[model samples]
Target: MSNPAQPDHYSGLLQGIGQRLHSARQQAAQTVNTLLVQTYWHIGQHIVEFEQGGNEKADYGSGLLDRLSKDLTALHGKGFSRSNVFYMRKLYLSFQNSETLSHKLSWSHYFEILKADDPLEISFYTRQAALENWSVRELKRQMKSLLFHRLALSKDKQGVLQLASQGHELQQPEDLLKEPFVLEFLNIPQSHVLTETQLEQKLIDHLQQFILELGKGFAFIARQYRMSIGGKHFYADLLFYHRILKCFVVIDLKRGAIDHQDIGQMNLYLNYFAKEENVEGDNQPVGIILGAYKDHFLVEYATASITNNILLAKYLLYLPDKDVLRRQLEKLLLAEQWDEPLAESDSNE
Candidate 1:
């Protein structure tokens, strides 16, 4: 026993015991969750096997799940609604191998993913959820935002397949780009007039969600990052250092379409960062001009001459129409068959 009057000894003992208790509680909760997930998977497997056994009496209709749900709730008290039992059946169908199921994801995560009809989309969400440890809420948000389609739109067929298989990989500067970056989380109405400053402030206010939308490897560095050139001052709208890319990413926000001057300014910022700000062993900085819209022809011609790793992208105030995006993605996938193979063969030649 320690004297209460001796604050140091008492505090140390209290903290040590508190930490141990917290850790133990976490371990216990994780064990219970893991067991629950495994048990649900087994139940799904059993249901599927029983259905396949040619039991016409049980296959009398969709009544099987309803009856099962009632019996389970009557016995176990909760957590087995008709919908939940249906998802369990889907869980067995979607991922037949119990060993392939992720222990990290809860049943809620699987439920959200199982709702997706596309196998590729399901696989992408599954891999991304497990890799990023996304909460059920986060998973729902991403699914609604059509994160897979957004990332896949820029990729060729092979790239799309890789995304479905490996999840988002931040290997280079281009890997970090997402066109029409969804900022619906900012909650600003598109009809409302917005200034560059107001948008920046709202982004800072929702910094956590903004960082999530920015994807992995981004670490916030500064806002309105100042730079000097020839006794004149310029401020970048947002500055981020990508931990994985090992470079600074300067973003300039535009309330409207990006102009030629915007391109020139971002190039200047990248040049300054590469020469003055970047320390040894740091890679060349990347610049992004994020605006409401841009003319593709104008951007292509403007950036074609400049050598800096500058990217131009749009930001939407509301969630994009997923159906429209899916159609566009389908077009890209279809075009890849005729385009990518030719390009690859040319490169080899």
Candidate 2:
């Protein structure tokens, strides 16, 4: 073989050079992206101005984009298509006088949202996407599934605005509970024979997407976390720490319907963590039982006796039909409203 020292020296030099080239490429990409965003912003501004006051003597402003697009494509390149020019105009109108426009949102993200017909909805998703630091793919998925509409249906108007504007706040116990947790990250089909072990492994493999699906502020703590009390040993499927809530979130995955015993078992896990394993400043451990199906009545009855912080929610392997979920949410809201009057009348006695 050749000299070992020579190989080591050459490898070190190659690594250094590779790192420098990577850094340079990243910087060049950032520079090019910034210039492109700025150019689009300026183009949008110019289009708006042209429409407002291009020439007072002649009606040249009406189809200026069409004529300009034709000439620019012929002379310059294909980037100045008529459709793209119209998007520029819409972009200016959409974000006029707003100071938040910046590199926080990429041009691709803006273009994706601009395809929406509703300006209000577009603005809402755009602001949310920027605040959440979502990729273009994530934005498209949210839009396709009508995440805003689902949240609006589930929460009150103020709550909806709060979630969209301030991001998810885990202040209250109820805030941690999402009716149907989105699991589009898991590529496994719903019909697949997926075991709990397989599901947990998949989640760990795609942990980043899992964290996103779990919402903000969640950091993975452990998987297959083991706990033993007395002669019995128990294991949690997944455990997370919510930074914002300052608590340990314990999740148990169940492939079938939830039972009363599952709630008790989860309570046991929570008690073990709270009394034994939790740090001095950590909040009481919260337990969530994610099952394929749950009987709402059984869940309420089982959880009612336990005073500890625990919740039972359903999980899906794929995105549920939005129309069906929306109707169900509406029905729940109507039932709550109908029950309120009866509850008030009963209390008055």
Candidate 3:
């Protein structure tokens, strides 16, 4: 009779073989994608050179792309539309160095990146998309949300450049914070009077998108995470573990402007988590008091004495105006007024 362990050993061998096959197939797909992207880049180069050989501006207006689309579609079929050809040309112009292209991103990702109006915006989205492993849909959403503008609003010129070059880096607690965190995905109208419970429920119902808004390294732990002390109960609105920071993040949602009491409660939650829930090797817990509005002076004074990793931010039900945010960022960079607070009124109710 066959040994009883033979089946187990055979199963392990099969598992290993399956994993290898999966890895090889992924590699093959990635290689194919990279080759196609490079091919399109070369095609763009050819188009540019052909245009240069004639009157450049004249050829552009003379429907070069329109004629090229018909010929290329007839020969190759599909994916050679005038708009796509225009994008391919733009792709080459945007990224002259083929080596700079990330293998992690597909042509679809680059197509979205090329739509950006500014070079810095393009670079920022490109780096962020690759590093965050964002899908085409996610990339589009982030672009619409004006994520680059949100992050750059507090940074100086050099800091803004760093964002474009390196994407959003999560080195410390503050790095993970964004003011007026966009909640458009919740489908909640701003005019509707929202309760804390309703807001929390909506966030839980759309946890995936919420985490995406939360940025990288956040893993949802619980909603209404409970803390019991002296037989009294306290519940955090949402609790997430940050893999990068090695800490628990407590989020407290407020329907309106946050008060001193809200800050103190969040502080209490941080202290309790640090002393009670945090295991060995875990860093200090972080607390974020998210609300519709904030009293800037109150926030500054209330948290002045508190020595904890706490962040206060606003949440909006609608997408922020890109022009307004962009203008604000420009002023911030030029002034290098890091201490100057951004106007919280930009979030439309």
Candidate 1, position 283, lDDT? 98
Q: Which candidate comes out best when scored by lDDT?
A: 3
Identify the runs in model 1 with alpha carbons over 4 angstroms from their true place.
1-5, 56-61, 338-349
lDDT string, candidate 3, 31-144, tens digits: 988998999999988888787888453233357888888999999999988878887888888889999999999999888898888889999999999999999999999999
Question: 282 in model 2: Cα distance from truth in Å?
Answer: 1.1
Provide the clash count, candidate 2: 0
Tens-digit lDDT string for candidate 1 (193-228):
899999999999999999999888889999988888
lDDT tens digits, residues 82-177, model 2? 777777777777777546565667778888888886554676787778767898998898777666555554465457556655555468666777
TM-score winner among the candidates?
1
As for TM-score, the candidate ahead, 1 or 2, is 1
Clashing pairs in 3: none
Sorted on lDDT, highest at the top, how do the candidates line up? 3, 1, 2
- Candidate 3's displacement at residue 139, Å, is 1.1
Q: After superposition, how far is residue 228 of candidate 1 from its true place, in Å?
A: 0.9
